[model samples]
Target chain A: MPPFKDLFKGKQKYVTVKPTSIQTEQPDGLWTKCTQCGQLTYTRELAHNLLVCHKCGFHFKLSAAQRLAITLDEGSFVEFDSNLVSADPIEFPGYAAKLEKTRQATGLEEAVVTGQGTIGGYPVMIGVMDFSFIGASMGSVVGEKVARLFERATRQHVPVVMFCASGGARMQEGVLSLMQMAKTSAACARLSEAGVLYVSVLTNPTTAGVLASFASLGDIIIAEPGALVGFTGQRVIEETIRQKLPPGFQSAEFVLEHGMIDMIVERRDMKKTLASLLALHERRHEAG
Target chain B: MINLTLDFEKPLVELEKRIEELRNFSREKEIDLSEEIATLEKKAEMLRREIFDNLTPWQRVQIARHPRRPTTLDYIGLIFDDFIELHGDRVFRDDGAIVGGIASLGGRPVTVVGTQKGRDTKENLARNFGMPHPEGYRKALRLMKQAEKFHRPVVSFVDVVGAYPGVEAEERGQGQIIARNIEQISRLATCIVVVITGEGGSGGALAIGVGDRLLMLENAYFSVISPEGCAAILWKDGSRAQEAADVLKLTAPDMKRLGIVDEVLPEPLGAAHKDREGMARIIKDALIRSIDELSGIPPRRLVERRYVRLRRIGEFMIREAAQEGFAEAASAGGDVLRATGPAGPKGEAKR
Candidate 1:
């Protein structure tokens, strides 16, 4: 009764039921897929590893709070400029709404969180950038906060450590964003003049205005492994040169090869590495 | 003799052409048409004023990018004397994109550094289309530091599309070099003046842009990113650059209003490209005035004032509840954070 094709189709429908285990959903926030190696990892394990992929060593971006938590001594952080927020300086379209939504979603007043904390028992002033909040762009508020951090550090004669992770100047703030480059750089100049040890740590994706300002002015510039650190973005460079970029272009390894950074440190070793550097530059007061 | 004509400048060009035609016609025919010629000349003058006086931000951007626009070299030749060309960053080969040396302004020795643009195709290639590399910025920093050492006022002229965005530029540490320049120049221990002569594009322009006084030419623009770059990033269309320029607030008046630039020097009737020498003379005068004004302050105070000027540049807000506590703490810290006060006199930041 069946033609050759119809006979095969009827036979294939005999076992259509699927297994229930594959269809059941796992609890949310329990697992994270590796962006580099495509490996499913327990979120708790990932956090314990400081958000670095255990399988492929991909250093995931960290929020300001998360960065502060892992880098500082337990319960030693005191935040500054927590009430500062951005204003629509240029009145760029949708900027206010974007800032509002980002503030709510990230629960942050600005992209960079300035504070005081001890690293490996060495007291230091610190500023950590949260890339999730608008690429940690250096808008007016970000600039003011960074400048204040350096100023405070300079006055207190404390070593300053900064975790720079930005996509450059915020476009919505217009030229005000551009001036932040000068503003922050001026502060770095003051810090250097005061002989304060400024350690700038470049995390994943530090480029453009931020890179060309305080991020690059560090006394010892250290970058995390596999971080994209450069003045220009890859897409912009590709378009300008009209060619595909080689793999690892603008990565921390590439930058180290080019002699831009002092060293490349892994996420887990960052705290110990920074503590030693701060200890080496620790100020000693003469006994009266 | 401008080789490039922009869309907005077309009407003024047409009016001037009509006036020229009338003059030629009268001379050729040996007719008494002086009155008609005079009338056309008056109309052309008014049209020129009308076009230049009320230029839109996008129009100013066009003028800034005009190929015939006067270059830094041209201004140096016209305004300064005894200009000895300097070269090389010592670590790298001399970059043609930036030109710098010691020169005399009105018999006062000053160090001059400027981003150079070429006049023609071959020159543009050599100049890398006015885009500096790491070496160029390094050379600039070297020259500026020398100026500081010699107690010479550093006068820098800026006109660049951006820092070069090529693979080689990236590999050579363009970002670090620029960062070094900005930091070193900020507390340079000498009076410094910066003039934005044309398109000041992003961090590239800012590599040599910080100073005690920032002066912008009438049609020149200074932006964090180029309008085309912003448009492509935000609108996903590079052609929407005109719209982006409007929103960037990059015009000279915008800079003045924002308290970023100290002064906006007026240009010739048809912009700098139309009257290069006149524009140079105006810039020369402004440079003299700025340098004189800045030279009066001692070096330490100059650096401190420079710090304060830069410190007060940004705009931000404080929540109403946090304002009082912030004000008291910031006042104790000093005037650096006084700009953070809510409803301050600058009125830059609002609740």
Candidate 2:
């Protein structure tokens, strides 16, 4: 073969490719687009980076399965309550259809996946919420699973770890959704009374009813680097206050400054951070 | 206080006005009009019943938000003795939206906490329109904890439009504070009696709302989200609040039917605003009865009962039967399986 430089100089046929065309032409699942920065990344590379944006560091939302696969020790998770699904207590209009469609799309029985798992050799009763399933809103099934997780952890004297990602309570279930806050909180109280450790990890867009319940009741609350964590939505706050919010209002960094969370851990270091914290608590418990 | 009136109450108000006018005319003319007045009075009573007896959920919502409705302070003034108002969360400023204190209910010492709304513009501003912040919940939590230590039962009156949706509220960790209150209140050694006096709005109300016995006024509404909010989200039109209200199942009777509330105390004709003292008297009796019943249970049992009561509030179904049913339905080319009544052997959905 001729020299590469010589070939390029002799027959320079430049084909200009537009970035938008490149994005559109690629197969759908091959590239993951960063929601915050609009940066295109190879899907496999992004997955390898724990779904954090390679360029902008935006933490993409994860499904409960993905969360379990990354956070738990390989093949260590034994799922719990995979059979529980929602019932329309009030017979909300169109709710059944919506639930059916969401279940079909996500293949999740409910918004939350609860299980007993080993995270870096420390066994924990864990529950991870998938926001894709109805915004991971705490309805009847979600509440029961979480309450059972805490109850089981209390009984077993095992530490519990929960990954919370929700918009709020499910509106379709009406006040039944609201009562889940109390249900989950009561379970959390029992866990605390039993003196079993509970660590809550908040992911992107944790707000409203879930935040006001067990998600906020964690003994040690950890947040992803850029998670939107707060009691109310930003638009609702702006409408109520009749003013613009300052930059970084409900971001993880802002919440840290306000002393709401224990720490902000990046996705890359989340497993290590969680393992260390669990080890510390275990050591302390043994010493005590 | 501004005399706010609902559209449905217009005919009742006009009838009352006519009755007053007739009395004035009889006095002015010095004529015997007793027979005519009695007939008119009977007509008015019928009209009142016809109007108030069949109130729609939307109408009750209006009553719950009525400016002239009895407030927390009004109930406190009428129902309790020696109501000394407590102040502050000690972590932050005292929230005027929520008021808490120690008082005697039928001669028994109890802790009282409530979300307070104001009668006028300035007072409403001071009260933040009864929407609490983190500090408000913290203050309620502090008082409840005190109640636990002192062995006094806790009585919380819920009448809020939800926690304040504001920046400072979030910055101060509103969610965490509310969560802490619910957790702490659930395990408080003292009995808790929460009354939904007016608008029991979402987690704001539930922050201090978990208790052994929950009583609600006939016209009061306890909702997950406001009708307006629900309407706006579901139908994309806030004006469809009436439909949302009808669907929310938030009225006292609805809650009672759902097994969420222990009792639905009747309101006076024309709702609580018409006879504040009468409404307070009704609530007083309910509180005394609830406190007495809850007080009989030991502290540990009280906590356990609370846990069980709360644990039973959700509705869901098991997937094994559902999946099997789905398989059958799919094979038969029929509809998806529907839950009959939250049936499961695990007792997770026991009513």
Candidate 3:
């Protein structure tokens, strides 16, 4: 619940001159004001409750694992491409070492974790993007892993549900990372063409090249209660065009009301809804 | 009663608080609150149904655009197998809007393409609200070509609002890209099937709109321009978009009647959002049959049929127009020319 003032300033953890890993050890007491109620809360408590604030009912940043555990059936997830990693295809200065450090710290090979699991007893494929990993950027490896998951699901003829949490395309991969968006989307398209049900779940803070590509092509789109959903951040968009956002702009529920998604699923109901849809799709196999 | 509590211990506490408050109030022996609670519950259910059933076109637009509405990623999990995502337009930058790759469609090898929108804020910033830039169109054209080359049928799920209109998109030649997609897809030597799965507005929709058989979901609307854009131009106001939508005949029934769409797939009683599986099956059937029909067509016939379809599109319009006023113009012109002894000025004849 840090004030968006710092985010507005774009104070990122970029070390342009140093190629070493920025292990930002806690510089201050790991607690701050709630984004909703301005109540001071401990960071670890929020982390334990899946980034959801206890007092003000505010949701904070969620790790990919936290998202998967919340979404999948109890102990049913099996991760795919856990070893697949991202390379600095763009050669952005200091990006590769930064990626390595983030990789080690997050214990995730790539930004996305493709999991095969049951949500409400229905067999489905789920991919959760971890923003902790390079802003949960979409890269070639992420795309490939996603595409492979799609292929697997298509072969299995089951439904796919992706939880997208990204900062758009990974700049470190340069055009290669950008290509991941199209590639991943193409894989989703194949799933759709094959008559397999594919639904995209947009999570908190999805943006950039990833949104432009495949994040929106869902059979039944779902978003977390208060996730930010838009093409650009408010500040950057304002700076670029010097225009103010309409009231309630870019929130998940607002986007839903605006006709962008199907439902604003609570953190709890996502799995059950997914399972019911999958089971129904299985019974109603009308494809040639 | 079955426990409605699934997760979030806090909500349970809040509900319990309300329940205790109600019990205490009712236990006073003077007032019976159970009836009020039941009435309120009934009212809530009725309101939910009314809201779900009576969604306006604008509200439907919102539903079609709900941020949480599942995206292509969700579908891949529900469907598809071993999807090897291909990259690059083979000529320029890869466009994120047009997603294309190889995968099995109901156990058959097929090339797939879809326009993707983002779910959260950062991804939407990246995906550009599911609008394909020129590069996105080019990428689709390449995928269609690959499908044709391999004799694999192509299935495209189109849901873009339109091509990106940014300076970057213009600089990348948006018009040329759209024109080229029209040209290539019209003559692409593969059985192409397109589904207007969602918005399907403008060229972003048409980039994938060309196909041997075009299908649209009941709740899905496809049009030459968005209703708002259409209204703004036709009525000089954007608010009349709903009327424009009704008259423009941009719905599935309208498009089907106009022969612009091959089939109007039915959703559930409410909408596809209510019955995602039902809608998926409708699409799957349309895709499978269209692919079956287009797959066995000879390469020459495949391209020829498409060309013929395009060439034949305006036959009714041309014929109808000819009958309505062209005949009178021809007759009048003949008389005028004869009266002038066939030596009239060329510019005067045009008038």
Candidate 4:
């Protein structure tokens, strides 16, 4: 979730009902390449499969909205802070409006969405990020909200599940944003040590500042299919080393294989998987 | 002429084909096609599940890194109660790599330490990809010590490739910070349990690695060096990483057998990414067991046992082939060595 040159990321509303086979005497479907597997995958096919390469099993790019769909129960999700906004405390050129545009474009208040919901009939705390929202940056509000969420979850005695998608600290918010990582992580740490079930789902593009803080502090980590789950992208590493990346570098599978992730799952199974997992957490708690 | 781009319109593909055929049969301008569009909408329901049935590891990584994947802040929304975030490594500049605070874990006071990676370009630069600097490690040490002071056990989730290696990080004494953690964590009296919830790499991992019990997620990895780095070192080419991984024996199954780790928390077949709840439950159970085990022992014993266990890493391993000759000779009636000689047990040697 860096300055990903994407404009209409999450809020790219479709004029058509859904992105089905829509051809109007013109070809609007774009040609995309799967960087990991190095195969020619149609944008539509990759999109249909939730950014996973059917042939090579490489995970494609994703945003927060996509994650909510994959993890939450169908029709059970209620987005929070659709209107919360970020001000240009740094006054970086065009940053304020940029935040506005990003908010509108991603359909999110800031970068994160904290809510109360159920994955499989198990009421739990939920936090999802939208990388498109200024690269899913963490700022004061983001941190504050996270801290509040943890406190709330502990109060409810419900397990908390967080999907981590961050570029790290929010630079635009300056030091204030950076502080949020500590604050939020601290909140998570308390919940975890107390023996409350804290499940963290590491998602695509988790890196940098975020990786150093709460994102890395999950009790249980789960990943989605074919995500780029590293703090440093292959591009940066390649540039640093002045060499080409190896096959499957930085992909979720590579991370999983490297022991960076707990599990790799398809989007369809995320809900049921979470439910069963939550059930087990309760059992463990009882036994404990 | 299949449109791979048309995943949402499988029925449309057929309808469009029929429309084409009809047009071929009668080229009059009196056909309306809007009616057929409505009929093709039903299959979209099933397609949702159809596309996400089975995901691959690479795909799962993507999900794990999805910009939309939840963040720590989001978790705050869903987990924990009465959470308060404390600041400053209580040192120079506050390190962002490690986050710790006071919060209730199952309504009990506990301290937590975890790595944080950023989601975007600028943030990534700032956080250094969850790679802690000396201060981050120090801050974690500070918080953990505080927990120990309160007689509260510490919980840590490890996820990082290593400590930051930037020039600034080096100047800040990253090594010193991590070394201090090793010293402090080893002697701390309170129970300590660590979970390799994600990537556990390098000394950055070791900074929080000194604990009473270590649990790793099923697919999570713990290694001295990343496979890619190892490949680069051995083959002078990072591309041979897969071959290195095949030989590294760094996976949970291998590590568990090696006794380097205590337990491998089982993830759903594909991974914990699919089953967050299941993963959470496993961690909770593991945490309880780990705490119970650690708490059972006296504090002094806890410290000594952990130290001895770490020191005894290679105790279980021996060069069988190299020693086989000497062992066999002794077994075959060669003079037995010191303590237990050939007259005692077979293969007993003084050398």
Candidate 5:
């Protein structure tokens, strides 16, 4: 078994922590309740469905490696900047220790894993963010990796696909974390100028700084079914506006309805969907 | 009286109130409390120093967001003369959260931009609590572009919690505008100076915050997220914001040490709220110094320097070993010399 699956074995931190509420905690073990539709799901069966509950089509968070496995062709991922670790720029208290704990738990040096991979024989650059790693916050290393991924993809004359699953910008890194939003967005702008097809796949809980920048700058934005995507939390907005938000206000369906995202693809069809996008782009390239 | 004193400043507030009461009593009763008042005044001054000097990161945050703290318009009014306020983004309705205009600073024509917040609840709603929408950023960028075109320096005041997260703001692409500002501002072919007069939260602060010389007031804060947000996300408890602030290192001194800020402009004795004009004068001097130093450089050189300054932000590996004197001194010294050595002017001379 892959380390990612093993990481989930006998422990399920992902299921317990929902983005919307701190009070909501799922019961431990094989049985889990979906926060969205409140469906009782068998954990094993849910994993087989790419962590999506079959009853409600709510996507569960996946580790970066798990995402790469499902999206890329077999044995195609060649990870870049794997050893680029984070530094305590401000020597932020307990940050290094917290980072070490997360590294041990997730087997990721940073929140994001950037690599070159093939999807249905189409070569591309890919980055997958693991929400398990410190809520997949974009710090300096994540920014550097994502920026490098785009630069490499543009240079290689191939498409780019990124799986975004973040809580927000990493607060521990202070201003450095916020700078990533600009850095990644600027990198995306360069990629756009190069005329490369960039597909951003928003997973469960893409919010704040990541959602406000490159995640929203994709040539084609695709969100997993029921993925939460927004610049800020519902609670924060509600506090500001002093009104109750609509149900699923920042959900994938809501974003699609609001014309922010291009489409919502299920886990079962994501690989095929990406392959078709690559093929279409190739045909367009030829025609042009 | 309705006092909005911070937790740490409560003792000082009490001292001041006692002093006030004693003064009134002395005036009304014709009693001599001069000796008592002198003693209390000295104690109050010392207490103020102690409290401010040893302020925790969270305390600094409170001061930065103080209700009486001078806002962008206050700074503009005090620093620049003959200001002509500009409006509208042209692409969308003018976002009042951010206000900018052409202004004169020490006889030099420059463009000034800043995030505007309100003093009270009604005005806060009108300005979106100083949180700008996409149009706000676009308007600032438009003004900045105009500054670049006219060969005028751009000065911006950064004081925001974050970009507005309203449904309308998101629908209009808030992310794109902030992102574009950072990108364009980095390559803008003119001198740029940014002053953080208050809260500098996340990309909202960063949108108009990047410049050749980023100056932050003594009590100002610039962070990726509000301490409350950080606390809520990290500890699952927003009440632990004080603890989060300590860990965030968002204070101006912390930012200066990290090279995120070029300089830390001194605020008044109590805070910026105590003396607005004094704080503004310090900011004006810093801006003038930055502009004068940068104005002589060619546009291309200015842009390159700004790019290098931004690119050099944040810390990474190899500091520990170097600090331990693991590397040879000769090589390290040579590397620093090479890195800081001037290349542009000498190359031109050679050509």
Candidate 6:
């Protein structure tokens, strides 16, 4: 058999730019390069445009705080289960150290932050995944937080809005991380049965286990423009198939053509879209 | 018989090879070496049986992924009759990774679906190495629902590492399709028999895995993630897969013991690859028997039983101290929380 490296020699086609902590830290007075277009723009200008590239319309990854600040009504967010953190039951080597480092680097308790917030003054449950927090991988904590968020939302009679931005299951927790896909999915199943509206906003790079779970179970699914949403990595698929991928295979536009997502809303218009949806659902609930 | 022999089966392969060499030499020389050849054959057979009987979890995983192993289509051809394959997820193009159709298993009509990995490189590419996309899953669900409507039993052969992890698959609601399949399959008004034919990895496997009676081939493995994925996550090294396999308890025997699988259908002599016909017979008999047994029950009861079966898997005892600590904390906070006003903590109404 040929060497493994020989099979995938020149197949790394997609250029994924890993956003640094420094780029996300201040969000002002700095120049950031658009991963898709390679055009640099002032950070303050990017923030004013909701971190979307002015030139090529590329959507940058958002932190959980930034997502909540933009989507939710002012000062209306009430977080739930904030203290829940993974205990690393498998005792994975360097897992504790890595979690500590990520915590310090991102200033977040876990990859996902779940809470109750008002979207256009309509009660809704929100769970936002921060891509900067260890690639926003779903571990037990992320799963539990999302599950509990849905449970609370169901009891309180509110719609759910989740911003999905993940790089699959967290590896540190091993099988525990994988099980989260099922656990969170089961919770979403219950929420669906309860007749609660779930609007899943697929941000840049939502793939693997999370994509297979609650992220896909939305009543009204939306995505940011040019966001990469898929289960397998592009490079892995190319290597396995030994073929060239079509242009924009995993992008939001490609997904829309495939009829996976309902619509692609720009970052600046995301709040308006979500608010309109919330109001529409509120009217339905009142009449029904 | 195949050239793809595993590490543990090296001795058996070598002995078999020697026996073949002696047979060829005897035929060429026109000499009487039949007695010696017979003795060597007996020894080889014994060695093969012994080695197969004591396989470790990692070895079973290897056998499950063996290139020569009979795949879903192979089993369908051998065991079932009139397999008319249905294609395409109505909303999108058909996915070749997962194949399903109406077929007759032992003269009983059933809807059959399974992940199809390729034998050669070309076929593997076409089938996406049996890692299904959202359309693949949606296709399976559609066929299952069709079976449900027709009051036919459903039998799915599982052999996938997981769902496809591509950007297109995710955009197409891969997770939602799989999760919905699980939810809908559980409540389907028909007997469902799931046969774990090969690698049953994670949610990808479980997407089409729900059934009243779950059967597994002796060498088949089912786990949340592949051993390599687990090793990479835990040890930061993919080489620790063997250790991960041992700890994951993903082998058929382990699954049977853990109540994840109803029965373990024993493979012939050296494993499924050595005797595809024999393996097919065993699987066919198991599926027919399980379906017959399940057919007598009402649809509601079968659905309830399936729910219980899934809920019971991976159930374990949490640490007593942790349980008590959590309960105590909850009780301590419950009173104060109840005493608070109707207004929420952040000044929002409680609704």
Q: What's the true lDDT of residue B290 in model 1?
A: 92
Q: Flag regions of model 5 displaced more than 4 Å.
A: A1-56, A89-97, A154-158, A193-197, A272-288, B1-44, B171-177, B234-236, B316-351
Q: Interface RMSD (Å), each candidate?
A: 14.9, 14.9, 30.4, 27.2, 16.6, 12.0
* Lowest lDDT 10-residue stretch of candidate 6 chain A: A1-10
List TM-scores for all candidates, in order: 0.90, 0.90, 0.45, 0.45, 0.81, 0.76
**Clashing residue pair totals per candidate (backbone < 3 A):** 0, 0, 79, 97, 0, 7
lDDT of 3 at B17: 61
What's candidate 4's DockQ score? 0.01
Model 3, runs deviating above 4 Å: A1-32, A42-49, A284-288, B1-351
Model 1 lDDT at residue B14: 88
Sort candidate 1 into its docking category. Answer: acceptable
lDDT of each: 0.83, 0.83, 0.62, 0.58, 0.77, 0.76
Name the better of 2 and 3 by lDDT: 2
- Please give the range of 10 consecutive residues that has the lowest summed lDDT in model 4 chain B: B342-351
In model 6, pairs of residues that clash are A212-B175, A230-B166, A230-B167, A231-B165, A231-B166, A232-B165, A232-B166
Candidate scoring better on TM-score of 1 and 6: 1
Better of 1 and 6 by DockQ: 1
Over B123-177, each residue of candidate 1 has an lDDT whose tens digit, in order, gives 9999999999999999999999999899999999999989999999999988898
Cα deviation of A200, candidate 1, in Å: 0.9
| Clashing residue pairs, backbone N/CA/C < 3 A, model 2 | none
Give a tens-digit lDDT track for model 2, residues B1-351: 566878988887888898899899999999889898899899999999998889999999999999988899999999999999999999879999999999999999999999999888999999999999999999999999999999999999999988888888888988998899898888899899999999989989999899999999999999988888887777667789999999889999999998999999999987898899899999999999988888988999999898899999988888674333221222221011111110011100000
A92-139, model 2: which lDDT tens digit per residue?
Answer: 888898899988876677889888878789999999988768778889
True contacts kept of each: 0.46, 0.48, 0.00, 0.00, 0.21, 0.14
Error of 3 at A130 (Å): 0.5
Off by over 4 Å in 1: A1-29, A286-288, B1-3, B322-351
